[model samples]
Target: MTYPQDPYGQQQPYGQQPPYGQPYQQPGYGQPGYGYGPAMPPQDQGLAIAALVVSIASLVVCTGLLSVIGVIMGHIAHSKAKRGEAGGQGMALAAIIIGYIGVAIIVGLVLVFVIVGIATDWDFD
Candidate 1:
C-alpha cells in the first residue's frame, strides 16, 4: 500500500511509536510550553488591609504622623493587591475612605477655628 506523504514527508504510521532512542515528542503534551496554570492564592491580605485602615483613621485624628504612616501602609497594601500578593481590596478601600473623612474633619475644624478667631477679634487700626 502506498502511504500518503505528510507535509514534512515523514511517514508516521497510525498507532505506531516513533523510532527508538529518537527522543519521541508528542504535540502539545508534557512540554513546558504556553498557557497558564491555576492561579495561586494571595498571601498577607489581612496585613495589608489592616495597614490601610490604620493610616486612614490617623488622618482624622489630626496626627500627621499617623496619617503619613497610614498612607505608606495603604500604598503597600494597594501594591500587593495589584500584584495579586494579598487580597486586601476591602481593607484598602476602608482605609482610603477613613483617611479622607479624617482629613475633611480636620480641615473643617481648622476652617471653623480660623473663622471664629477672625470674627471674634475685630480690631480696626
Candidate 2:
C-alpha cells in the first residue's frame, strides 16, 4: 500500500497555511515585549519639602547650631537625590536653610548683647 506524502493533509483542510509563523522565528525580544515592567516612582520630593520646613523653623526657634547642621544634611540629601543615588532631598534642603537662619540669629543676638553691655555701667573693679 502507498502512504500520502502531505503531513498536514489529514489535520488541516487542504489550502490553509499554518496558524502562526515558523517555529524558529520567535515573535518576541526587541519586539514590544508583554506588559509594562516595573518602574521607579517619583521620590525625594517629600524629603526636599521637609528639609525646607525644618530649616525655616530652626532659624525662627533660635537654634543656630542645629539649624546649620540640618542645612548641611539637607544639601547632601538633595545632591544625592538629584543624582538618583538616594532619597531624603527634603531633609537635606531643610538642614541648609536652618543652618543659615541659625547663624544669622546667633550673630544678631550677640550684637544686641554686646551693645547693651557696653551702654550700661556696672561698678566692679
Maximum-TM-score candidate = 1
Q: Which stretches of candidate 2 lie over 4 Å from their true place?
A: 1-35, 41-54, 88-91, 121-125
Question: 76-120 in candidate 2: lDDT tens per residue?
Answer: 678988798777655665567667767788889999988887889
lDDT at 83, model 2? 98
Candidate 1 has its poorest 10 consecutive residues by lDDT at: 1-10
lDDT of each: 0.66, 0.64
Residue 93, model 1: Cα distance from true site in angstroms? 0.9
Tens digits of lDDT, candidate 1, 1-125 = 21333456655555556655544555435666556687765467776667775775586457755665666677777777788877776787667666656666667878998898898995657
Error of 2 at 101 (Å): 1.9
Name the candidate that leads on lDDT: 1
- Clash count, candidate 1: 2
RMSD of each: 8.0, 10.7
